[model samples]
Target: MTLEAYNLLGWKSETVNLSFPDEDSWRLDAILYEVDSQKSFYWLLFTGGSISIYLLIYFIQKDSLLKAIRKSRLLFTILFPILLIYIDVNRIEELIHLSL
Candidate 1:
């Protein structure tokens, strides 16, 4: 259905069916980019968790995984910049605390 929609929308489609990693894989990806900053932590955990939730929801939808991902992609995209700011703020706080 999603593929059909994409086609109807006149979006260029990729021949390769790229896939997202599982929850465990996402968690591992999160670990790789771990930061001491709280924002970074939240962004990492939230996005990873969101992806996991999205996948779960996608499974229940009985639609293509890619289609489900297309819908859920918004959450990560929307929150990414906010998470970066969060990490920056946390980093500042840590620097202040160290200076005090």
Candidate 2:
């Protein structure tokens, strides 16, 4: 169950309350919002939470579970945080260099 599936099933919970046109946009919005902050700890917490959900799904599915989680952790720790920091830093630099 995704948000769309939840909506279809008429599960009007808090998570379902914040519906976007699509998943990609919702994720992008989440990242953008989080990346603007000074606290990378919040970013790590958010990323960890999302990964935990995916890890749960991986465990439930049960086909090569260990491999799936290893891959997920590798990408999550190595790529995700790097990309987030790179984008956030660039954005901050742009704002700092902006001329009035």
TM-score of each: 0.30, 0.34
Best candidate according to TM-score: 2
lDDT of candidate 2 over 1-100, digit per residue (tens):
1222234366865332233345346444554454456367447756775876677577657657676666556456646666766677666445333311
Candidate 2 accuracy as lDDT: 0.54
In candidate 2, stretches whose alpha carbon ends up further than 4 angstroms from where it belongs are 1-36, 41-72
**lDDT of the candidates, in the order given:** 0.52, 0.54
Give candidate 1 regions above 4 Å deviation: 1-56, 59-61, 74-82, 93-100
Pairs that collide in candidate 2 are: none
RMSD of each: 18.1, 14.2
Give the worst 10-residue stretch by lDDT in candidate 1.
1-10
Which ten residues in a row are the worst by lDDT in model 2? 1-10
